[model samples]
Target: RSGEAAHSGSSGELVRVQSGHGHFVHLVYDTTPAHVISELRPSVWVRADRPGIQFLVRVVFPHVANPRTGKPVTRLLAGSTYTQQGSWQQLRVDDLPKLVQAAVRPMRSQLGSHIDVREPYLDRLVLNLYAGAGTTRIAIDDLDLPSAVAVGNATEMAGRAAQKRGPAESPARRRVELAGNVLQVDGQPFFPRMVEYQGESLNFLKGLGFNVVRLSGAPSDALLEEAKRAEMWLVCPPPVLKDEPADDAQDRPMVFDARYEPVLAWHFGQGLTSRNLEAVRRWVEQVRRADEDAARPLVCDPADDLAQYCRTINFGGILMLHRYLLGTSFEMADFGTWLRTRPRLGLAGMPVWATIETQYSRELCEQISLLSSGRAPEPAASLEQLQLMVQAALAAGVRGLCFASRSPLDAQDPATRARAMMLALINIELHAIRSWIAVGNVTPEIKAANTEGVNPGITGGVLQAGHARLLLPLWTGTGAQYVPDQLAGNLITFVVPGAPEDNTVYEVTVGGLRSLDRKRSVGGMHVVDDEFGPTSLVLLTNGIAVSAMNSGLPGAGQRAAQIERDLTAYRLARVQEIDRQLARVA
Candidate 1:
């Protein structure tokens, strides 16, 4: 709730807050450069009429406690630039700090010093409190910031200003790729929510030079049309999970049940309802008939419940799905073996993807490859398992290998999560990008082999038509911080701004790429040149950028834009190299 000051309100001298969803509040304030703000604690008092003391207040700021770093920032006091806390309990005057009491004193006591007036410019303050029944009071005894001054209604006013600032740009949307005749929507490699609003997503992507948007799940037809309209590519999957199970007489599991819920939720989340399934089937046919040249591929989920439905779901689209999660059990192995022996099942293609068992582990790499190859090694197998999977997938004449998220829920912040997801996507798509890198080079073939395998893979109908693809998802719900250190490789299924499961490729050229003084951004893919070597620049191509670039002289901003253009060209060259290698191997 907005920490506004109003006289004669209940819980006199205490900001009245309720308990429910969206219960958390935020406090925003300005600080002097020198004060070095730290631990701040605010007291929350309950109304005399309430059953018990109902509120606990604590300081909140943009900064978060860094456990890995040394001791947490300790400098703090009652009156800090920003302060917030959460609790279901109602607060009384005595429970609050002197600053809060003074601010609201007109409604209650008139005995103390007038509430310190925080500078209006510095007055932007917010007090975010989370309240609910049962557990009522929680207070922060300490925090850190500079020049503590509690301003009334300062938090809400500042929060509104911040909201107007809009969402932060994602790092994944920066790079541009000129794919053959068409451009790939190059922005954040893949985001789930983008599949729902494909048009706006693709337009946003294309506007920023993204070459492809991997259309996952059951995106609406309009979404696909938007991608096509934006001249972007899509990687689609079928909707087989929509069909009723063979045994309708059996009781269905709840949405939370791991066995059935994930798939059902995913299907439902994709907006695929029972009544609309037929309509979707027809649309799938239409997509196939209309754009044979750039039709998106149909990918599938490997969950057990979705097995037999693959055929029905595939709906004439290229079949792709992960192998590792399909199952690591002996029963799964036997079932896979039997299924492979079938003639009809053989008709469809299986593009394999490997996920890290944990974080970055050699065992994960090996196991992923092994599972992709069509062999079922021992469950809980390590790197050795990957080799077997890869071989099996290859033997089955599968399309190719996809590397998905490495650490899915690792990041706490939503923005940081978006960055991680983007990085992973970029890494996995290296094969595709490398293809374009090989173009225009005199000795392309030799370089290509060194990068992408001479042959990418073999598809049932068209070898290149249904080449292997990678899916990188930005997990939502993580707390996101606009940390510069994560901008580079933030594509690995991490987080994005507004789109819950989408990512935006950050433009590194335009913005002066900077990171936390001690930390480093994901540098796994940064190409360094000693002298005249590679450079990193953050780019922006939104309406603001276009307007700024066109009107401004060739000054600092223009130079940044130029750097963006140059860096994109350089990256594209590298990507072409990978593409050529895939073609060579293919």
Candidate 2:
């Protein structure tokens, strides 16, 4: 017999037994019955003395009490054979269910009655290790008995494994395709009318006529399932890592200890260390595995490195340019510069999305200060300011719009209520013309013909989608950080080269089509004055006149008849004023 220990066991003893032909060592542990019920297939790690050392490990259950009868039962709960020798090899009991069934079959046969062996109260676990010929020693340690819940969640474990590998593209289950500046689902042009706020259910969005929701991060499995049930598409932004290194002071790579914060903070400018790259790769894989139909866009500032990284990851070919924190003037200039210089970043073909802040100035400042070290200089844009931003982006050919607000929608204060109404109206209008907006080809910049005394901030553009042509004229408030009340009522004019064709009728309406004027064209170029308050507009087309009234406040929809009546009243008043001016001139 060799007294020298092969490996240290859990009992701090070197378990070595010698027999010319074969030998066995038995270790027993008294455990509560609940432990056995919790862990179905417990396992332990063992090491053999040398290669090709044949051994058998079994877990014996003794003094198990039958639930129906008070009799004790002895059975082999689990067992495994070790043919290969190595350091710390795991011995897992195979076919536990079959073994339990086999043990119960004989008990039933002897008693001549059906015996329920499912819930057996186990009293002890006897671990036995048997060595084959020429085997001298074995070492065992680290017994693990995991609960049934842990054992059943193999899918989550597989998802984690997939994260280690690069993200795999699943077969198109929902069939959402991005083809040349257009989004199509199931072969139909789909315009994503998306809400950016997070909510418990998508019922509110559906009520507002939105078809998609944009989330800052990946939604949970339960939320994704719920969205699928609600028939709404989701656009999930990739985790936006902080620009600085994980350890800003030491400039060391970030340690991904937190669940998702570290990974999300990985972005461009920061050198792509192995950890950062791994984190990004894992994030992509995790999102892909979570929901195949969800669109994943990288939320990043306009930068060459970020664009390159996005392209490398094969992201959903869309990059959201977030400029909401910056004031309106800066945002407009930044958007224009990025749109023009996108090709320089190797993002020529990718579409860029814009975010609209829906908070008041004070609230915006508070939120921005909290996010940064009190360095954010700009306040949040108001409802009209946000409208101007959206219109300008649209004129500059942005592909999508996201209304951003940190506050929840359930807030019923006056400001929040007004914001909700405005958002609802915007959504209604966007949903109505989403198909056209999604596929429209933008024309060159359209400037005011007579800017002699007009607001220099006025800008216009044209979008031609199929047979529908939309002329968008936007008037940004006077170049002031805080817009004056007088600036809200500026008048901007658009010059239509010629009137509509014989069969076409000129339909003019508000920004959200809240008001409408359906009238035959005069067949000549004419200048139309647009009241720049609330970002409303005049839409002229060959279709029936559909008008929407702004109500100035939120949540009000206008009927066609009401819009027609309002248009007549306003036009008549304007004509009378013009006549008075002409008479005074004479």
- Scored by TM-score, the top model is 2
Name the 10 consecutive residues with the lowest summed lDDT in model 1: 441-450
Residues 1-586, candidate 1: write the lDDT tens digits: 2122212242223344443211133433344322112323323322222122222233222222212121111212222111123323322212223433233333122212332223322222234443321133333221233334555554454454344334452211112222331222222122121112123345543322334444345456566446545555444443343232345545332122111111111221132334555555554454444333333344443333343434444433223334332233332222223323432442333322222221223465577668778443222222222223332332233332333333322334433233233332232222222222122111100010112233111111101111111111111111111111121222112111121111112322222222211111342112221111012221112333333332222122222233334334544765686688789879
For candidate 1, the per-residue lDDT at 415 reads: 31
For every model shown, what is its TM-score relative to the native structure? 0.23, 0.49
Clashes of 1: 145
Off by over 4 Å in 2: 1-172, 237-304, 313-315, 325-344, 360-364, 367-381, 450-457, 484-493, 496-527, 530-556, 559-586
What is the TM-score (0 to 1) of candidate 1? 0.23
lDDT for predicted candidate 2 compared with the true structure: 0.48
